[model samples]
Target chain A: MSAHAHGTQHFDETKRANIKFSAEALTTIENLMKRYPEGKSKSALLPVLHVAQAESEGWLSAEVMDYVAELMGIQSIEVFEVASFYSMYNLRPIGKCQLEVCRTSSCWARGAEDVVDYISKKLNIKEGETTTDGMFTLKTVECLGSCGSAPMLQCGAEYHENLTEAKIDALIDRYRSEGTRKNYTDLNYTNSK
Target chain B: MSRKLLLTHDNVPNLHTIDVYRSKGGYASVEKALKKMTPEEIVEEVKKSGLRGRGGAGFPTGMKWSFLAKPEGVPRYLVCNADESEPGTFKDRYLMERNPHLLIEGMITSSFALGANTSYIYIRGEYFYVSRILETAIAEAYAKGWLGKNILGTGYNLDLYVQVGAGAYICGEETALLESLEGKRGNPRIKPPFPAIAGLYGCPTVVNNVETIAAVVPIVNDGGDEYAKIGIGRSTGTKLISASGNINKPGVYEIEMGVPVEEFIFSDQYCGGIANGKRMKACVPGGSSVPILPDYLVCKTATGEDRLMTYESLSDGGFATGSMLGSGGFIVYDEHQCVVRNTWNFSRFYHHESCGQCSPCREGTGWMERVLHRLEKGMGNMNDIDLLVELAKKIEGNTICPLGDAAAWPVAAAIKHFRHEFEYHVLYPEKVKDSKHGHKEPIMPVKPAPVMA
Candidate 1:
């Protein structure tokens, strides 16, 4: 659905420094680095990328990756390799809303295809296609551990499970009305225990 | 009512909070463990309880804990494998989502028992919401002096942190999880010093599943022998089953290990039978990795014994007519579901998730996916079925991790259980090309078990 840097980008020092993360985000990154033993700040790379992606645009550009590598005291290639390895880190810019529907065995058998088709048609887009307005990006991911509540789609930090056409319609309408980029680090999607 | 050790307080409102959890006898185990019991005594109790690892491996937890090499002045680690990305498996997610404190309390008690001062719950990045819930609970634990230096004044200090993974299923593997934890790719490590000797940060570590860690709370509270007395032989204690697919009531169920498979699937108390009055065609008793069982063999073993949900009973007949109790991910397939398409879906998942460290898994999974895709699309020759079997055999134990075997088992078992379905697809392609492609009746061979290639 989204494009990734194919491991050919060079880390420019000036570009890395120009890529600014929010002051709060930098503080959070520094705090995360403290979780590991001294000289082991590399352990904070994944979490820092999460906060970085949220603080910057929805995706991690090469400059952003370089920035992360510089901050974590590791090579830029290290950040690139780790970031590309995970599906959650969007390397390229994505739509405001990324609807990752689970398409593995349990979700598939329980009608995930129908959910995808419904969302695609509702948004006038196909699988892996962002809408013309760049309001939504549709993706078919493996599983998000909601097998029991299958036919589920994950947007940002929220899981919308047991989908129907009406629910998809309502969800899309709500997102369009809200016109906000849903992010994983957004505290509003908190599902209280 | 079935006994639920971990989720006994699941329906209790605000059970996720430390106050409610502790009010309901939550941190008592931490108190008992830190103040009264020694680390060796806890390990001995777990060994006596017959608690097996619930993260699909089913290794004895006590034996695993005892295997930790406690050398002089070495910092051993306890990492809770919360990377619950297995298909049809969400028990760990459900456990953490509803009852965060139970797992936190378990982590504290377990870290004390494991003699580790620092522990981490390496949750998948997808569950950021759940991680936030856990972090809040951990903060509460810290505020109340349950964590940090000198916990409970018993001189056993444990700092529990929740580290989120980026999105990789291979990270669920212990070594791969360790590598990811160290800010590297999620490729699995080659075994034989294993994790007990050399794991996280290249130190001796004990990596356990979320359920395995949470079970430690009850083991400490009620004694492992008492916990052992609840379920059948070997499969002691209750297991959390993440039931989904073509079922009337698809949700998480904590069942005693000795419950009959029929009752659990058909009875109103559990899955409540096939959805929309459809007949059950097949079932994956454990997670997607374990072999699938045809309807005929789902309720009873080949020996006509009532199939129970215990580890020993569910896998009574080996892979021929049985499946392992893998992560307790129970997926039921109705008569309307197509086996060939399901096999292809699973193959594609493996192909996507394989970390490419092992060539056999990385290449073999893609090959199987392509073949299964061709077969599912009704474009396969008769030889393609056997070719699929051949590919599965080649990939089955050839990888650095079980992801290859996990990818192989469903393909082999799909053909093993439903060869006729594949043939039907080949012989009559037009019948399945339309939108109304449902396997009306299944032809399951019960006489002779097909020998694995």
Candidate 2:
């Protein structure tokens, strides 16, 4: 019932039939569910919702939330409450590259506001607005645990840190040229290890 | 240049891999805990170490573990509170990202001590990269006999799982974290049924910070008494301080407890003094949640006693002239930084992060943000300052969780320490509106216009 007038929450019934996890993703979800006890597969809802968001573009459609609820054996309201509570989950549509810059104390002290302003000027879009080409959506987020490397932003799974105006320019150019929808699943799990 | 207990080999190569970690005596504590010592003895050793929780509250770790309720046929759970979303705190992420196997080994030892067969690392969602690092370490742990099933022919079976929370700052609260781990909205549960008694599917649960669990490694390796000998007074063992903001070296440093606050800030080996050769104006020696202290108060107490980083020393004057060593998130602010704007930024963060479960926190945080915004933007009268004080007092002890307190402290501290800055914004409205006052330097120097084609 909590609605933001950015995007339609309802999706076509036909789209719901097609929306699902890939074989490998399903295996990952099953393994995740196994981490809990019997009849506690619902505990995997948050992580699984991330997977569903990755699969169905960058944001969570109502159909995707319902599907996640079904997959985890929880109610639709449960999924909606969770999806809305978290800042990471975008209920509406977003650009190909969602630039979530940290605007908290540590990052702010180190010039996060300047970085936000720089990105806005470069993209000609205000914070939380997608570019006309649907290439970038600039958003200011809270601390992302990369405070040491302050004035940072996250695009897909990449954390661009120690940001300068020139670095922001270069990053914008790179993401713009990539020209593909960068899903949350675009993360490189191997690189982090 | 200080003693490094937990981060002993922070600079070692291939430390992330289990093979490299094991080569350097990684699972020795697990061996010591499981094969050598009994569960009670392990608990006794932690109590002897005098180790306190590193995740902000500074609770006694050994006493916390001893409080776990054990009903027959009911399993106990150990959850590592990796949801390190505190604004200026990133020490846990650094530990888990660079030296992850240490945390896993620590988890195994802790799980054994608590008789817990299942454990979880509930990390913040934004640290997706660090989560994978932890997962890889966990898989490597399982591949060996360190985790899962009986270990070294001992009748102890343990399963460790990593649960990633979708971004909620309130989830850092233990009860809220349990709700999040149960895949629910992270609203802090009212106490009386604490997590130790009834938590996580109504089972006995022990939630500790990643640093707290990882510190158990050293406490088990070296006898608790030996570990206790390193630091002064009750603040035993070395601690990880995540230094950021206007400090020259903004990273995680593992320092022996009882280090002098001034030395930690100005010394060459530590933060290396204020950034850009600027004078120190103010600081939140802990994370953003703690009271902000000006230069003189931060270095020494009102009684002129040298302030040390210990819990007792840092809070010598009790909020009137003291702050906390909370979570060891040392944030420095140069004289150029504006207190009004910084307070406004913190207000916005709290407002955005409020879970909206309690009306005081939900509505009060928003009201504080709006008032601070007007004050910062030079549109407020002087009475707004008194209004902020009143609202902060009302919200402090009235909420279900510490978040209301967290939100209230910065505002209260800013007003307590830097009322002149707010007055400056109000008095010189036009001047303060265009050019931010208090800070002598610009945030980011405007780069020259790009060469026109």
Residue B262 CA error for candidate 1 (Å)? 0.1
**DockQ metric, candidate 1:** 0.58
Model 2 TM-score is: 0.95
DockQ for the candidates, in order: 0.58, 0.54
Q: Which ten residues in a row have the lowest lDDT in candidate 2 chain B?
A: B441-450
Candidate 1 local distance difference test against the native: 0.87
For model 2, residues B224-273, the per-residue Cα lDDT tens digits are 99989988899999999999989899999999999999999999889999
Docking class of 1: medium
Model 1 lDDT at residue B228: 93
| Top candidate when judged by DockQ against the true structure | 1
The true-versus-predicted C-alpha distance at residue B104 of model 2, in Å, is 0.3
* TM-score of model 1 vs. true structure: 0.96
* Model 2 lDDT per residue over A48-167, tens place: 777778877688988888788787778899999999999889989888899999999889889888898888998888998888777888998998888889989998768899999889
